[model samples]
Target: MALIITDECINCDVCEPECPNGAISQGDEIYVIEPDLCTECVGHFETSQCVEVCPVDCIITDPDNTETEEQLRAKYERITSDNG
Candidate 1:
């Protein structure tokens, strides 16, 4: 699944740089994760980099945008291909 930043986010500006997909962005109130761009770091890392760096643990899996590992990999490929 993709990740979502909760209201609990402290806006410390940590998670944004950690996201390889550039999915995290500053919102009106908190950091927001774009589900379509989030691959949970499947192809880039063993775990989610945002979750690793977030001090408040405000990032959580987005149940509403759930996807399997294979699907996540596909997304990663698509994104990287666009960049290439």
Candidate 2:
């Protein structure tokens, strides 16, 4: 599943640079995760870097954008290929 930054986010600016897929960005109020680009770091790391670095634990899996591990892997490949 893609990750979501909830309203609880502190806007600490730590999560943005940790996203391997460049999915996290500054929103009007807090950070936002682009579902299409979020792979949970499947292709790049053992864990989601943003989640690892988030001091406030504001990032969470999006139930509204649920996806399987395989789907996330595929999405990661697609994103990398397009960018490559």
Candidate 3:
């Protein structure tokens, strides 16, 4: 599943640079995650980096876009593929 930032987000800017997938971005106020690019750090870390760095625990799994480990890996590969 991808991650989503809730309204509890403090906009501390802590989770921005931690995302390996480049999914997190500044929105109107709080941060937002691009579900298409997010792979929950599947190919890069043991867990979600945004969650690790989030101060308000706003980043959580996006239930609406549930995905398996294999699917996450595929998404990661597609995003990082050099050959495209």
Best by TM-score: 1
Worst 10 residues of 2 by lDDT: 13-22
Give each model a TM-score.
0.98, 0.98, 0.94
Which prediction has more favorable lDDT, 1 or 2?
Answer: 1
Q: Model 2 over residues 4-50: C-alpha lDDT tens digits?
A: 99999999999998898899999999999999999999989999999
In model 2, what are the clashing residue pairs, if there are any? Answer: none
- Tens digit of lDDT per residue, candidate 1, span 24-78? 9999999999999999999999999999999999999998998999999999999
lDDT of candidate model 2 versus the reference: 0.94
- Per-candidate Cα lDDT values, in order, are 0.96, 0.94, 0.91
Where in model 2 is the C-alpha error above 4 Å?
A: none
Candidate 3 residue pairs in backbone clash: none
lDDT value for candidate 1?
Answer: 0.96
Which candidate, 2 or 3, has the higher TM-score?
Answer: 2
- Model 1 pairs whose backbones collide: none
Clashes of each: 0, 0, 0
